[model samples]
Target chain A: MSDSLNFSYTVDGENFASAGQASVQVKKELRQLGIAPETIRRVSIAMYEGEINMVIHAGGGVAQVNVDDSGIEIVLKDEGPGIANIEQAMQEGFSTAPDNVRSLGFGAGMGLPNMKRYTDEMHIDSTVGVGTTITMKVNY
Target chain B: MTINDIKNYLDAEVLCGEEFLEKEVFSACGSDMMSDVLAYVKDQAVLLTGLMNTQVIRTAEMMDMICVVFIRNKKPNEEIIELARESGIAVLTSSKRMYEACGILYSSGLCGKAE
Candidate 1:
């Protein structure tokens, strides 16, 4: 933990065009660290999905990534309308995103599922009317 | 096959990463929904889609895709092309529709499975 690298970014929900910036940067950083391509891909894809979800559903949020000897951990925190049903939201085709968001090539209801699929470990903490925090990890 | 092979097969015009036309790609997938691309894709080297947006390029980048062919001749803007260029991913635009373009490539021996 002491020698771990920490990176954080404020995801801008207002700009859909820039939603995946954090994930891109993280990917570059991971690559520079000489992480395995598969591990980096898993971490970046999971984080990218989380970033898009924050922009589309939570009106933006904060993303934090910590890389240590054991693995990489990503935390996405947002203060928006929290998910009412986490299980239902996790379904492959379940989505609450608007039609316009779909027009941008997402909103097929695969965000959370994809995140869960890529990461070695994933956890979602949410309260209706409050906010949501998701934690995901990829082993090194 | 190489990116050049895809370019010739689909009659696509290279928009960027011309230097990478020699890059080899073992598999391909065609889709408009990026989430599906993200979910089902496993080491697919080339992506064929009609969707036009920076997210398309971003999705390819996340999946570590090597080439993106925009079917229906959907020309992405300068920003989208630049993003692909930055990621060292080849960009191609073709007049063929998604189904036909995919068929041509599939018949050319490109499967959805990674080599």
Candidate 2:
């Protein structure tokens, strides 16, 4: 258990029901790896928020996690309509998500902030109409 | 309150995790918004949400929540139930609306204790 491990999943952009599957898997795997509950929780929460963002905004995307003794890193890449304003999106309660996404209890504009809150580091790169990539880390 | 007390208080049906009924929960929060629950919830062992989806189970899991009480008699699908079962989160349904259910539990001394 001295080496790093990597896990990847393709987020089903169209299906909101299946959104958190990858984060759940990561949580289980981290637990089995004997990661502390608090660390596992932080990583899982951040990743879950990112996963939901992928489904709601980007039309599905790639989620990759790398775990090691030092920390865990999560990378989410999406090709949906890219974020036009990252600053605006980071503010709590500022949402551009449509009515349907709001009904399901997301798009409250807490996604990015929640991700940032739970992680040690977070970075976002986006090109409107191209895609968005979010990288977050939770250190062990 | 122990999950059993919540069950008794709400007259809710147990959807799963009957084995966990005796477990105690310190605080509870009711919200249909999963993200709001995630952002605002802390050390709340029970989640009362009407939103029926796998994300509900996942949100509970993320918060390390022990129980989910679906208000307004909203029943989760089989997948959500299975997910909750797997996550070791107890599931229950209450006919009472969100306000009434939370009110009952709050009056019974369950506050979403600040962390």
Candidate 3:
């Protein structure tokens, strides 16, 4: 909140139409901040995937982004049926989303993997029935 | 190829961004799954998908894509067109199926990741 630029948004669960609103806002802000195209692209894609995941799985959550001199950090928190197996879930093509979500052009089991791939650092913390918190960072 | 060329190639209809026909795109891909597109796409300027939804435009926005071609002559609703318009992306609809559409674009020199 001080020198570091911070932005936050509340993601609505199962709201497919508005899922990427936060990511879009972040992209615009990053562009206005004059962040490099490559960095902005990575951050936006990763953040968008996380936002979609929040809607599909956790029913909605919170997204927070912090931009500093070193890099950018994205934190996503959702209170849903948490990932039962982090190891299996990390594997590409493994998804817990229902078929209805797949019909909407997502739930390909690539969201988490794609998020990890686009970020320099990623961590996932989850519980059986509580929720999940994912932290991702991309260094400048 | 430019968005104009795609219109001529597939005999497609421009649903939005008709004024931006001269836009140039280097690569393209066709998929209904937005996740797959987001996961594997890199520098692909055109998205050929049958999926008609706001997320289609949102995905293109995230990827910085210039055009979205709806395969099989699938028409997007007014809201979808508005999203594409606001996102500054050209939207087109082609009668060609996904396989044929991709093939036509590929043979016309719009290479995918294989290139």
Candidate 4:
């Protein structure tokens, strides 16, 4: 495996069913590269949560994954109504998603928390009515 | 328990991945909330949920779950089935409700992974 590999994906918010495609691809690529299963699981879960959040809140976004010898980094950027209170949003059981999304089995307010939990490092940047960018990293 | 046993026990209809019927499952989790599943980690487990969507399959994939059982007689759409099939995760549907389904599995010795 190479020391570093870069992967980019464009997430479409128009289709809820299509969310998590980027995470799936990253999982496959990591498997092919023979990364550890635990590390892969953490990366994929963090990325999947980010991907779902992008669809549900941001109306779609861009995902970039960088795999290297030391670790994996995932960056999710979206141009949508930014998070009003990062502190409140980080709390478990707090959600702004509509009832419809909840019915689909998501919007449990665990997305950001799970991302932070699974990744060794995480960063969130958002501007009101502008956009949000989340960076997460999981060490191998 | 093996996935085959789950199908027979729940009278579930196998929607995909028949080839994996013999695979062993050590634990199981029942939830419609993907976040809850993400909050917990399991090994070689089966996910039982009422949520019939792509995120369910994706959640199972992230957890390395080998099987997904949809309760309440709910059937997954073609796209969901396709996603599960591609990910090599078995999909099953049962007429039992979520509580009954989890109860049966628990009594049969299927438990959630330890923290």
Candidate 5:
């Protein structure tokens, strides 16, 4: 495909069980497009982490995926309470998530790090009490 | 090892995806934390966890895992099992504890390293 393909979805903030739906759909779409399995997996993991973050931290957000010949780009924008310390948040075991979140098997403070681990590029923009936007890319 | 072998090793019951028992898995990871499972990369892996929730299935899907084995006799609810069924991931429940289950699988050659 010479032209880029774009997909967008509104991530639900409530109901943690409903999270990761968009990532699942995107994974299927990438498969139908015949993207490499490894590439598709990387994209799915990064986007899934971002989606879970939006639901757990931001109370929901917008997730957009742009697939092109060179790579895939994922944008996650959430209007939840922004991160107070990006550096600390990026740490492997630093989490601000409440006890309830940990009980559900998330909030181990690995979301942002995992996103960065699987993607080729990652950028985080945030302001306290405002919102956070994360952009990540995975090259073919 | 195939999913069937994992079932036999743990003496687990197949909760769903019975048709997929023959599918092969190269690696395995045992964790209750879904995020920790997502943090690592494993090819054609089996996830062993006591966590019973929809996110378990979702995490397995995101990682493209072939099967999920619930440890400590932990049984998932209908919603979670249905999610795994829809994703084509095998689900199994074993009476073995997490450590013992992982030990059995690991000793049988299911290393955690990605192939």
Candidate 6:
């Protein structure tokens, strides 16, 4: 084992059903690397939430994952409508997702909060009408 | 409780992961909203929800849940079952409603809180 390993993914915006595929793959990879179950769960949940947000709000994105002896880092970048109010968006129940999205079992305004909850550290960069990029890390 | 115990107690039909019947789960959460489930659930819990969708299984997988029990006799489609099987999550369908199903499990010693 090296000190770190990197994995990258291109998220597709066209299909909602395939949103979490990248997270699933990352989870499998982490498991194969013998990361602790709790750490894997945290990483997978944060990444899955980010992936879903990318599809629902960002219209698509790229996810890069770096695994190392110290921790796992996930970066999600998208070129969609950026979040206008980071504070409001971080609120648990404040959501701008359409009703159609809610019907699919997401858009409950818990995405960002969940990401923050499961990760040890998180940072968000956004430009309204331009895009948003989220970086999250979970320590092993 | 073991997955098989849950199936027997709820009179549920196993939809997938039959081989995992011996697996144990300590807690459970029932919700239709996947967001709430992911936000609050803990390790190795069983997710009992009425929501019949592939995302339900995906949510369970992300949370590292071991089983998903669909209440109201709601049966997930083939794709959903396939996804659950791939994730090694036992999928079960029960005729009981959500509240009743949860109550049955709660009283039967499957506390909803994570350890």
User: Which structure among the candidates has the greatest lDDT?
Assistant: 5
Per candidate, native contacts kept equal 0.85, 0.78, 0.88, 0.90, 0.78, 0.71
Candidates' DockQ values?
0.91, 0.81, 0.91, 0.88, 0.88, 0.80
Off by over 4 Å in 3: B113-115
lDDT of 3 by residue, B4-90 (tens): 999999999999998889988888878999988887656748999989889999999999899999999899999899888888999
With candidate 3 superimposed using the best TM-score fit, by how many Å does residue A97's alpha carbon deviate from the native?
Answer: 0.9
TM-score of each: 0.98, 0.95, 0.97, 0.96, 0.98, 0.96
**Model 6: DockQ score:** 0.80
Q: Give the least accurate 10-residue stretch of model 6 chain B, judged by summed lDDT.
A: B36-45
DockQ for candidate 2: 0.81
Docking category of candidate 4: high
Q: After aligning candidate 3 to the native by TM-score, how far in Å is the CA of A38 from where it should be? A: 0.9
lDDT of 1: 0.93
The candidate with the higher DockQ, 5 or 6, is 5
Runs off by more than 4 Å, candidate 2: none
Give lDDT tens digits, candidate 2, residues A2-93: 79899999999989988898988999998998899988889989999999989888878999999877899999999989989899989998
Tens-place lDDT per residue, model 1, B1-115, is 8999999999999999999988889888899999989886567489999999999999999999989999998999999999998998899999999889999999999977876
Clashes counted in candidate 5 amount to: 1
The per-residue C-alpha lDDT of model 6 at residue A42 equals: 90
TM-score of 5: 0.98
User: What is the per-residue lDDT of model 6 for residues B1-115, given as tens digits with 9 covering 90 to 100?
Assistant: 8999999999999989899999988899999889999988576799999887788989999998999999999988999999998988999999999989999999999988777
Alpha-carbon runs more than 4 Å astray in model 5: none
Off by over 4 Å in 6: none
Residue pairs with clashing backbones, model 4:
none
Alpha carbon lDDT of residue B63, candidate 5? 94
Q: Model-by-model lDDT, in order?
A: 0.93, 0.90, 0.91, 0.92, 0.94, 0.92
